[model samples]
Every structure is written in C-alpha cells, then in structure tokens.
Target: MISQDVGTRAISVQNVTKQFGFFNALSNISLDVAPGRFVSLLGPSGCGKTTLMRIIAGLDRQSTGRVVIAGKDLSLTPPHRRPVGLVFQRYALFPHMTVSQNVGFALSLQRVEKKKAANRIGELLEMVQLSAFADRPIDQLSGGQAQRVALARALAAGPPVLLLDEPMSALDLKLRQAMQLELRQLQRSIGATFLFVTHDQDEAMVMSDEIVLMNSGTIVQRGSPEEVYRQPRTLFSAKFLGEANIFTGSLRREGNKSLLQSDVVNVRFDVLGARDTGAGLVCVRPESITIEGASKEMFVGTEPNSVAGQVREAIFQGAFRRYLVQVGEQSIMVQQPVLAGTGDAFSQGDQVLLKWSDQAVAQIEDDTNG
Candidate 1:
C-alpha cells in the first residue's frame, strides 16, 4: 500500500481479509478514501463488498489488516463505539417510533438532554427536507421517505464517515435514481465521507467520486467513473463496468503501429501502438463503432481500421439505434443517434461498413477467469 497522509483520509483499509472456514470472503483488500468524498464499493453478488463494509463498520471483524477511520484505527472497536454511521438497504426503522423519534434515537442513546435531542431532531429533519413529516409514523412513510428518515438518523450523531449498504435497492427505479442524486448532494453538503456499496453500475457511476470495483474477493479497479469506464485496466473491469465488444487476437508490432490477428473474428485489427501482448484482448464500446451502408467500392480501399459487413439486426432505442453488423465470423454492435430521414437508417440485411479509431479501442489484460 502507498503511504498516505493521515490528515487526508477519512477511511483507510489496508490488506483486510475475511475468511469463512476454507472460503476466503475477502483477500488482501486495501483502499483509501479521502475526507468528504463519496466512494462506492461496487461489484456483483458475493464479491465481498458487503463483507468489507461490515468490517469497516465493526459489525464484522476482518481476519487481518488494519481499519482506520479519521486517523484512528477502529479494528478493535465495537460497531456502536466506532466513529462511523451505517445505513442498510432495508433500514428497518422502528415501527413503534415516529419520524422525530427515529431521528433522535442516537441522541437518546448518547444520553443527550430531551430538549437538545429534540432540537437536533428538528435540525436533521429540516436537513433531509422531512420536517413536515416529523410526526408521521414510520409505518405510514413511503419507501423514499423512510430512507430519508433513516439517513437523518444515521447523520444525527455527525459521524465523520457514513457507510451505506445498497441503501436505495428497495426503491423503484425512478425513486432510486432520484435518491442517488439526493444522497450525493447530501454528502457534499454535509462534507462527510460516504462509503456507498452497490452492485448496480449506473448507481455507482452516478453517485461516487471514486469507484472501488471488486470481483472474486479482490479489487478489480478503482478510479473516477470516466477513468474506470473509458480506460479499464483488466478484462474483468472492461466487461463488468459496461458493455464491451471483446475480440481475442495475436498481436504483432510493425514499426510504429501494431496489428492483431484475431482467430475468433477471422480478421486483423490495427492498434495504435505496441503493448504487452502475451494474449491479446481488445475491447471497443458499441457506441464507438460507426456504421454506414457499404458500397461495392468501399471494401476496395486500404483502410487500416475499417470492416466491411452486413447489418444482421437493428434495435431502435428512444434516442439511438443499435445495429448488429456481421463481419466475417464476428458480430459487432454499433449505436448511432437517430438522425433525420429515419427511413434511410440501416436495417437488417443491409450491407454496411463498420469503422472505429485507434483511440476508441482499448486493450484489456486477461484475468484469471478469462
């Protein structure tokens, strides 16, 4: 792990592992989150994201490694004693309590005076924009409203860090998306480090300042949304984060350029330059490919990165059309924005030329499973 400045990090996890009998749930997990930043722990099911969050929250202990929050190691601290707040997917607000009561729960536990707790609850409800509903029963609140109350309760103690475990998964898509924005705004406004955990790629991308992508109990990649999405470092990262058109090939360097001979696609690809090519895997996003109707003379040119193909399928989304172009044994996807003269768009059985630039294609390193 790189040496970190103690003052900058709100949470630091170093070489943490959690094992259940012979099964390793987490393997040498190390991550550093800066103060007041929204960082998402993202991965598929059983990837150890929740396990890691539990460890950080002190609900579950790691087999090894140190967990530090706000410059103090919390490895030995109990959940309630730790300087972190937690919100879960199912918040499980007390059905017997009112919204104000729930928001003041932590303050009451801390033995704050009744007047002080009431004032704090009032401030929290105002912050969450639920002051009007402070007296409502928990059983009567909507899913979104309950989540807001849960968030207010978590924030009542003003912990330096907040850990959310798929907090919006219970809401519908529209409400979930709206909550993503609201949660992000709340974190920024409160200036607290938020460690959000989710398996949804779009939610992570929309909410996180940095994404810690996990797979098979290990960190696959960590970066800003654009960096990890557009410049993935591994095959797992490329495929998991978004849609990727993958091609396996043998790489050969020719002077300043590199060419790949694909055994699967039965074609050659020109790459921008040489790279470590023990087993070449290239990834291009569907949106990067441009498709136009192929002419008889189009294949005659010596274009470096063009594929002569025929449209095998086309799907029209609201703003764009998705076309599957068959070039030799490979079928490539191309997405183009809908333009004027919709009747002139490429359709199935239409001959087309597919092309993309060197910058549009990225090389991915094969993972253990690949």
Candidate 2:
C-alpha cells in the first residue's frame, strides 16, 4: 500500500487483488490519487499496470478489496455505471461517424439536450484543437487527429476521472512526444484526475505529476519523477528507470560517516542506520559520474570517491557523449555535455579518472525477484 493521500482523493484502490485461476495478475495493490493530478502506472508488460487500470475503471472486478471513486465505492459496478472515461491505444473511433458525431456519441446516448450536446461537442473539439475537423470522417483523420477525437469523445460526458491505456503507443516517436505534452497540458487545464497506464518510461516521466512504478503485481515505488529518478529505493527501481552503475560492498564506519568498501573502488556516504550495515549494494547513475584525463603523477586509488579507468567505448549521442569506462573487472558509464569549445571529450582507449560526490551514491536493496 502506497498512500499518496495529501488531500481529497479522486481515486482510491484499497487492497485490490485480481487473480486469473492459478495466476495472480495483481497482488494486494493499494493506491490513492489526488484530485486533478495526472498519475501514470508505469511498468513493463505483464507487470499488471493495465489490469490495475481496468479494475479501477470497473472493466474488471477485483477478487478482493474495494474500488472507490470520488467518495463512492464501486467495487462491483459495471463500466458504464462508473463515473470514469476510457481511451485506448488504438483510438477506437468510429469510422462511419464524423468527428463531431463521434465526440457527441456519449452525450447523445445520455439524452443531453441537442443544443447543449452540440455546444459541449464544439467546446471539446476546440479543446483538443480539432474544431476544423469536426465534420471529417474518422477514416480521413490522421493518426494524431484520430487520437484527439477519441480524447474529446471521452471528455464529452465530463467524467471526473479518465483512464487511458497507452493512448499514444500507436503514434510515431515525434508525434507521441508531442501528444504527451499536449495531454499533460489538457489534464491541467481541465483539472480532472487522470490515471494513465504505459510501458514507456519516458512517457511516464514526461506526462505524470506522480509516477506509480509497479512490478510483478505490486507497487514498487511512487513519487514525483525527479524523486524517483534521483533516489531509487531498490535495485529494480534504479535499473528500470534509467542506466545504473551498481556496486556491491561492505559498509564500514569512519567517525559519523559510512563508507562502502569494495575491491575495485571505495565510496563515501552519510551514515544510513544500523540496518544498512554489513554486505550491501549501492547504485550510481551515469550522469552523476564526472570524467577527466588521468595525470601520470596522480594516484587515483588514493583519491576519495575516484577510480582510474580506460575508456572502452565512446558513444556520440547528439547533446552529450556516453563513455563506458573500464575499471578493473567492472565497467562504469560516464556522460558529459558536448561543449563546442571545451575540447574535453574523451575517446576510446583514453585513460580517465572517474569521480562523483558522496551524495550521488545511493544505497539500494537488491531485490532481483521483483
């Protein structure tokens, strides 16, 4: 249970578990989402992100526990009866209907007044920047346009919460990126709680106000994007979110500070606690490491939090360069910005000294099974 309850919760799933015969897809998942916040369920496929979303949306019933939306318990409620909207990856627009008609489909079914429905449809189309394409057939709309139509339709009935299942997965890279920002902006402007599910880490980082990272049918971690990225709690969180350089060492105390002792390198950090002692693992992100040319007279082993290494591979990644540095038996990655006049880039086979601050080294549990 990861309770994100700060104020009023727009969506809450309490001890919800779903099982398919012998298989447990979601194991005792509990989450709370604040009102008007864009929360993303981020994890790899088969991690049960989509299944959790389905349970919250009333598309699937939980084997145990309850589902609450806006103070209402809807554990056994059907999809239509729940006050939630759904948008799928495939757009799911009607090819036979025009954009306006599709957007108004929910309104018509609800028997909203004709003039009121038209006004709502126009506003939704305008909100998604597709008012000009209102009369266009779904088949004639481009991929991005069709996606907007689907969003507008979902928003037509004005559901308090929206559950989107990898809605931008079908688009190309650039379009997908563009839609991520657009969707985030739309969520903020409308002030509706959005529960989004996606396998793409970038998508979750870009669009979410809070990222609920799930794995193996349980919530691994949940926090702001920067919080999750900077201070990962477990080995899986560190490796799954981004590239991590992992080290195994024994914890030793020097005065009030704690140090990680290893054969290849030694790391210094603030004292964690009594439970953090003994054999443990720590992770350092690639960008946290700084690299410089090693001097012949410099003794790298004597320097604190520094290691001597030879560059094994240098990768040019437009804005920055990624270098894989070989230190004894292990490889450490170092990333540096491409400054035009700096002439500081290291090449393959170059001898370098890698260093990082003690604050950058984070202790993590090696939860391999998760």
Candidate 3:
C-alpha cells in the first residue's frame, strides 16, 4: 500500500486566486499533496491548471492565498530560492551544452565544485537511463531522449518538489505511453513529490495517484482515477473524462428503491438510500450498453430500464463495432466487439434493444445552464 503519511506535506495551496484585470484565472483553489506522491492537475484549455501550477512553482503570484512547500511559507520566496524544479512542455535544454553539462547547469549555478557536479550529473544520467548519451549534444537526441535529459536536469539539485507542465504532449501516441511508464517508475525510485499538469485525461489517469480536475479557474473534482470515473459528480466531468450519454430526468424515491423518470423513458437506478432532489442527470458510458436480439422474447419481461431503438448507422472499428441508434430525435452510441460475423448481424434500420444494469448508471448534478 502507498503511504499516506510521508512525514509531512510536500505542498499546500490555500485560497489561491489569480486574476488579470476583469478576468479571474483561478479562484479559491486549495489542495494538499503528500510528500513523495504523484498528483496531476487535469483540465482543458483556459481552465487555469497552468496558472495554479505556476503559482505553486513561484513563477506566478496569486492574487490572494498562501503557498507552503516543505513546511516553509513561500509567499515571499522567489522562484530561485524555493526547493522546486520545473520542466516545461518543450525540452528547454541548452543547444550548446552536452547532456552532462545541461543536467549539471543548476549545480554549477549554486557554486558546487565542478568535480562534484560532474559526479552528480553522471548519477542522474544513469538514473534516467541516459548515461550513454552524456557526451551527446541536445540537437542529436530524439524527442524522448531530450525529455529524459530535461527530467535529469530538473532533479539535479535534489529538490523536494518537481513540477512537470505537459512534458509529453509533443510525442507520438506509442512514445507517450512508453514515457508515462518510465516517468512513473522514475518517480518511485527517486521518491520525489511530483505535480504534473496535463490536458489529456488518459495521461492523468494512467500516471496520477490522485487527480485534481479543474475548469474555469476552479476545481471541479479531486479523487482517484476509478473514483472520478465511476462517480462523476458533475455533467462536465462525466463528459470530459470520456464519452458519455447523459439523460436529464426527475428522481422518485419509494422506500429503499429509486426510479428516474423522463419524457422518453423511466428507468430504475440503484442509489444508496440517499434522497435525490427534483431534477438530475444520469450518465452512462458507451461500453456499458449491450445490444440484445430483436426477437420480442429476448426482452419479454424486462422492466422500463431497457429501450428499443432502430440502428441508424454501423461502422466496423477493428476491435469493436460502433452503432448509432435513434430514440425519438436523440442519437445514442453503442459499442461492441467485432467478431467474425458480428458486423453482418446488424444493419441500418434494424431494431435492437439497448440494455444496461441500474448499477452502471451514475447520477450527476445537472449544470447545463451554468
């Protein structure tokens, strides 16, 4: 099990806010990251995730609030004085310096002896698995190699906190996956607190121990990957993490069970005895839906949770077949694995039943207007 108590908190942000004239970039943001933990700030563009990160790194000042790192108040500390390292989206390496010199640049600035800095650089290069490239120039390395160099450089000063801002955004899909695994392992071995910023949900889900999701200058949700994915509290979060079909309806409670009622359908949903107010939204993942046979006997005694719709379009997607079905004027998407004859089984205009268990539905706050 991962240790929650890492002696002391690595970083803390309380009531953090940033503004530029009439625009508020961040608003009342607060969070705590345990020492040696990997936490990610995830959001779309213009969400202030970058602004929050910059605040923590002391590169940008907050309009109001306190930022503490390693138990020291950083309100008056400049970026250079803080025990933090920042890796940018671009590699930001010196074109003229070799890999070893680049990683040792920070140590050199601190007036460390040249021999000791060289020894530390050698060790860091080995830690990042780039020892063989120590003598190579920055222009001679691949994108992934350059990223490793940047990481080694950031860690050279042994900072207690490491901040990465979209470090892998420029790599290809395969290379990005490879680097994610490498970076996670590296973090474990070094035991440094990491605060990563990313717009990609998949990247955050794969690498973060806890994810802080932000939108429009405020935090929307913060939790583990599974917790956030399984129980999205807001409509924006449900749709932002992945593709989801949302249905707005009223919820009725009868004794221990609850039922959701809408104009097109009424579905029984599982909820833990908690009272649901008037109108709410139900979110269903595409992969959770199953298409049943067209025969009436197939759904003979099924309850109101199931719906029958006609297929409007079907396309083979290598591993799975994607089908678009029309229920009234709304379109619902269903995905199923493609077997040898599965594609031929369903055609346009064919009737199919879309079935899902009540436990698969997640209720979210309806925030369509705001």
Clashes of each: 0, 0, 0
lDDT of 1 by residue, 1-370 (tens): 3245854689989899999999999999988899989999999999999999999999999999999888887889999999888899999799999999999899989999998888889999998899999989999999999999999999999999999999999899999999989998999899999999999999999998999999989999999999999887788899898888888777777555566557434224345443735568888888888887777555522465577877889898989999988776788888889878755787889988877787776777889563
- Tens digit per residue, CA lDDT, model 3, 187-305: 99999999999999999999999999999999999999888888888998999998887877788875566777766556667777545668777888888889865753443224656
RMSD of each: 2.6, 2.3, 3.4
Output the worst ten-in-a-row residue range by lDDT, candidate 2: 1-10
Query: Model 3's lDDT to the true fold?
Result: 0.86
Error of 3 at 202 (Å): 0.9
- Global Cα lDDT for candidate 1: 0.86
Candidate 2, pairs of clashing residues? none
Which lDDT values do the candidates have, in the order given? 0.86, 0.89, 0.86
Once superposed on the true structure, which residue ranges of model 1 sit more than 4 Å away at CA? 1-4, 263-278, 296-302, 340-343
Model 3 spans > 4 angstroms off: 1-7, 296-302, 338-345
